[model samples]
Target: MADSVQRAFDLAAEDYDRTRRRLVPGFDDFYRAAIDLIQFPHDSQLKVLDLGAGTGLLAAFIAYSFPQARITMVDISSEMLERARARFELAGERFRFEVSDYGVDPIQEKYDAVVSALSIHHLGDDQKRSLFARIHGALNDGGVFVNAEQCRGATPERHRFHHERWITRVRELGVDDRDLAAALDRMKFDRAATLEDQLQWLREAGFRDIDCAYKNLIFAVYRGIK
Candidate 1:
């Protein structure tokens, strides 16, 4: 299952970054809002881990924001990480790349922040809950967890509305029918949970100051401090 998902990401790796903006509604602000939550002195050498760090889109922003950060980018696809490697080639030891399925991997390293974007939504509800707990345990005191994710709506009707809104908006952004079909194909693997359930899971994982920092349609950014 993981291997097939990895293959899917690998297949999409080349065009992933270019099409991302058109595919997602409110792209810039959604990502900027997530970046805002990791409060730190710009020079701090923070230890950061990005789970399922596909093509390093989110990690690139983080690296730019926190220049001295020791970032570990973990994903199930080497193809994706290869792009990440090319993206961060000059960073040298400042960035580390690993191929691992974080949903089931042991994150034993203590990090100042653990972040993921558009990745955890692929996990089952049980997997998400357990992963939340692991993330909390892997954090240092005062560490934070930030997730920029796709979520389900609070109800079935709302889910339908959200779906419609996304479809309409993406089209407006000039994602053609073929591209939209491909995007929908990828979404088949998404196991998005409600924003409410995810917030509760963070709470259960012993996170404080948990909040849905930003939301639009079914896309949301969540932050929690350990």
Candidate 2:
């Protein structure tokens, strides 16, 4: 699985956006909905942190949506971060990038908002739970944490259905069968937990008002207030 994951994204950074654009038609809308779920005040400025910010997809959207906000993009992969930094270079002083691991890092400062997309599922359940606690500690009072993730469905039948749907969607976009198989193999390592479980974790981490704001099969946006 590790080999497959390394191969799938190792040097495929150049084609990331192209592949996603073709495979995920409603990507922008999903991101928009996640951003809209945040109740940012109009008069006050915000410090927004984007974790596992692969290629800055969410960062760019947040920057555009909340121009007054100071945005920080964090990711464990340097190659992905390079692409993300390059993409948002024109945003000038409003953006910053950091290389960090979410579960292990000690979050020193607080943020008004925390966001992540298509990430976090890589971690096991315990790590995810710990990360939620860390995120709760990283936010100021009444701050928000939003995660758009790939979650496990309620039943194995539903999980299989979502997998088939994902395969169909990717195949429709002309992703090579070899790549698709490789991607699926890597995805098998994903210790994805259910949305209900994640919400419970958030609650245990002391976050309030936890809910899912958007969902498409396994993909959903989970939000909570700190």
Candidate 3:
């Protein structure tokens, strides 16, 4: 299942960054809030890790925000990472890339901050919990993990409403049929957890400060500090 999903993303790599703005409502604010919640000195030398960093969209934002940071990005899709590589080519050794499935793969080092965007929902609940534990272990003291993600509604009625509303909004944004179909196909692998359950997992992982920094309908930015 992960392999198929990786292929789907590889196929969409060329247009993934452009389509995200349309598919995700409030795209700017959703990401901006996540960046804002990161409590780090702008000029400090920080080590950051990005998981499932498709096209490096989120990592690009992080690089711009923290010029002194060294970033390592891991993703299952080499094609997607290729785009990220080209995007940050000028950074030289400052930016690094790895090809791996983050859920089952080992995270090699500790980081001052670990972040992921529009990823992790593909994992089952158990994988998500296990990954949270790994993330906690991988962080340096005072490090933080932030996930900007899609989430499932807690109840059937709310789930239906949110899904329908997202469909309507994306259609209103004038998404072409090709892109829409591709996005829907990829969503088939998404195993998004409810907001409450996700927060509980973070707590069990030994994070100190946990909070949903921002949420809009089914999209949210959650953070946990070690």
- RMSD of every candidate to native, in Å, equals 0.8, 2.4, 0.8
Q: Residue 11 of candidate 2: its Cα lDDT?
A: 63
lDDT (0 to 1) per candidate: 0.92, 0.80, 0.93
- TM-score, candidate 3, is 0.98
Provide the clash count, candidate 1: 0
Tens-digit lDDT string for candidate 1 (19-87): 999988999988998889998787889999999998889998988998989999999989999999999
Q: Which stretches of candidate 3 lie over 4 Å from their true place?
A: none
Instruction: Please count the clashing residue pairs in each candidate, in the order shown.
Output: 0, 0, 0
TM-score, cand. 1 vs. native:
0.98
The alpha-carbon lDDT assigned to residue 79 of candidate 3 equals 99
Candidate whose lDDT is highest? 3
Each prediction's TM-score against the native? 0.98, 0.90, 0.98
Model 2 lDDT tens row, 18-109 = 66654553676678778887788644578988988878888877877777988888877778889988997777878888877765788778
Error of 3 at 4 (Å): 1.1
For residue 111, model 3's alpha carbon misses the true position, in angstroms, by 0.3
Question: How many residue pairs of model 2 clash at the backbone?
Answer: 0
